[model samples]
Target: MNRPIAVVTGASAGIGEATARALAAEGFHVVLGARRLDLLKGIAAEVDGTAIELDVTSASSVAAFLDAVPKAKVLVNNAGGARGMASVADADEDHWRWMWETNVLGTLRLTKGLLPKLIDSGDGHVVTVTSIAAFEAYDNGSGYTSAKHAQSALHRTLRGELLGQPVRVTEVLPGMVETDFSVNRFDGDTTRAAAVYQGVVPLTADDVADVIAFAVTRPSHVNLDRIELKPRAQASASRVHRG
Candidate 1:
């Protein structure tokens, strides 16, 4: 039998990179997509997978990536991040717009573009990496949280709409994973980023990757609809132990 294929977005780093590696280890031919071609190439080389230049915010780039990949049995929609930390009143309109573009619109566009292929696979799985912010909001989290909420809603709708179809939709909501997410959101403010998870045992990218792999590897009859993985120190979005 031919090996199953998994396509991972944001494959250049963090959970996306780790998930791609995990899927490959689980005997899936992985297709990595990200804007950083050099990083994507390196990751693909390490995982023995294919790499495609993808900027999720760009429809043409996303279309090109999907066109380049062979039929995929699994799709990891993990290309998203917050842009800045500013209260809604003070938030820059551009930053808010960018967040919506990348976090909400991008996910929808890519998922729609690949829906046909996934449905035709007969045993397809979609694992969307959402965040606790989807359920709980925080100060300066207006734009980011709203986008996540939209993404989660999309997953739920897909699950309900695909009922009886072989396609499985799972949403993974993780809290405080140790990654460049905070740093990037803060525009490389290492101090602020470090403070976000201070004294807290944050989730690792591999932890989320493990869950993603498990979700996709389950037998066709088993569909894990929703998973919430939080660090022990993180009881909720607003409550984090910094001691």
Candidate 2:
């Protein structure tokens, strides 16, 4: 009577936290990973899931996280964020480095680490949470955009590479959801963060989690390669309609 294991990174808050709850409701024994151990533990307690401290940007941390996961049926690569919005001409290397490491390399490490376990389960699924920036470029967003593009490419490539295998790879491209993303990008500027969602309603973390839950619940023969979701006010990364 054991439930399938689903490991969700960044499960401390936002989409990751919501997804963990959603999956748990669907009867999966969730393993929540994030650097925020206090938040992670609290959420895990509520969801009846395991809380493991994980810093996706660190190789040793990823290795240790993987050690805790003896087996997994699903892995959600959701631990990533933007650092800043400096223009290309004034781009901060530090910002770019963090973006690349977290979004691009982070996905690679987690997916590669769990692929064996996923495949062994006979119905493995890899869900990567990339941004709308993955397919569109916007001004002052080169670092975030580039990292998402690379992350998307990595996830998409697996669809073809693991075609004959039991593993399924799905890339989720989300436009805008109200979360700590903007606040973090602007260095704790809550004013700026609130402005991003003002005048126009944005998607909620639960909205995206609903999609992830749906994707994984589908039949084994049905593979959802890519899922792009956005609020009605958003048309693209740089195009959002405001009242």
Candidate 3:
């Protein structure tokens, strides 16, 4: 079957993995990319898609991943994470660097590398999974919020840059998702990660994936510019109703 190709970054787990599954179910030949070849291979096998080892933070890896993609009708920039939550006064430079590299440059590298193919496909879609932090700022979360803001800017700018082109740009901003995101942010502190979602229900990876699948499946002319989804218990980045 000559299915349209949909490339998903950070496909080893969480949102990336779920998006890969959702896109595959949508009949797109999903190309899963991540540092975990083991997990990527398994997910790809299950989805009947291609698995490519990718570290979006590395330009060479992005180049190689893009080259492996014969054609790209959709690109899902989901390979990003946050690090230590430190106040501005005590900000850890290393954490900040990692955040900038993975969340900002990572998205840039992948999106820029596959842009032409997306345009050439004649009906392309770029779905960037940013965060509610993209617009809202919270204490001790400067590292992540700033990076997301920049990523969101890059994705949003494409709207005008690709005007009159066949490509569509959509940004998915999710709030308080219960994933390894917190665990990684806390440096593998699973207990801390568990506490993040202890008070209220958080959005699942599949929920975000479902939204992405719907956005890309829309008619070619209908462009869903930006979508912000969160659980009912969440009102904003800092205003979650925890009981």
**lDDT of candidate 2 over 1-243, digit per residue (tens):** 299999999999999999999999999999999999999999999989999999999999999999999999999999999999899999999999999999999999999999999999999999999989999999999999999999999999898899899998888899999989899999999999999998989999999999999999999998899999999999988788999
TM-scores, all models, native as reference: 0.98, 0.99, 0.98
Q: Considering every candidate listed, which one attains the maximal lDDT?
A: 2
The local lDDT score (0 to 100) that residue 67 gets in candidate 2 is 99
lDDT of 1 by residue, 35-95 (tens): 9999999999998899999999998888888788758789999999999878978988888
TM for candidate 1 is: 0.98
- Clashes (backbone N, CA, C under 3 Å), per candidate, total 0, 0, 0
| Candidate 1 stretches greater than 4 Å from native | none
- C-alpha lDDT of candidate 2 relative to the true structure: 0.95
Model 3, global lDDT:
0.94
Q: Give the runs in model 3 whose Cα sits over 4 Å from its true position.
A: none
